[model samples]
Target: MTISTEMLWLIIGCAIVTWLPRILPFIFVRALTLPDVVLRWLGYIPVCILSALVFESLLDTSGPIVSFHWSKVLTFVPTLAVALLTKSLSLTVITGVVVMALVRFML
Candidate 1:
């Protein structure tokens, strides 16, 4: 298949649009030195986001009452343990994946 002129420009435009936001922050922030308090506060952002995502997936709120997904809760126990004990992001992710696979297999 041949690429059309319009399609090529469209692709380039999309690439610029997608790349600018991700790159602009670093470029702008590189020159400025953030204070210790702001840096410390920024550190908690990832943890807060991850916790929100995990908790959202672990509970079912479709009905009037909230309910726990037992399989996810079971998987979370070991994953949380691994995260706390190892303090390794990779190990925690691996533990969560393996435990989730096992839970799905057994159930």
Candidate 2:
């Protein structure tokens, strides 16, 4: 229940380590002007990251071979529909979570 002095120091050290990487980018880029192409390319980062995460999560790889989860696939249906129709991240995430929870509870 009580944190020792050493543990406190460890926590402070971890905080500084985590904070530096996040803050350094802003400090270094504040005055810099990136090119238009670079800026345009950076716009796709979110979509690419999301696609990678979604595909990885949908296909499970706990064993030697990659396997697809029907629960996730089924949940993705309504989630994708909502995302495409509304184009809202919040709604899509909520729909996915609700569908997955229902699928898990029912099956």
Give the per-residue Cα lDDT of candidate 1 at 23.
99
Per-residue lDDT of 73 in model 2? 94
Could you give candidate 1's per-residue lDDT for residues 1-107 as a string of tens digits?
Answer: 89999999999999999999989989988999999999999999998998999999999888899999989999999999998999999999999999999999999
Query: Can you give the TM-score per candidate against the true fold?
Result: 0.58, 0.72
Candidate 2: C-alpha lDDT: 0.93
- lDDT (Cα, tens digit) per residue for candidate 2, span 1-107: 99999999999999999999989978977789988998899999999998999899899888798999879999999999999999998999899899899999999
Q: After superposition on all CA atoms, what RMSD does each candidate show versus the true structure?
A: 4.4, 2.7
Taking all chains together, the TM-score of candidate 2 against the true structure is 0.72
lDDT of 1: 0.95
Worst 10 residues of 1 by lDDT: 60-69
Off by over 4 Å in 2: 4-14
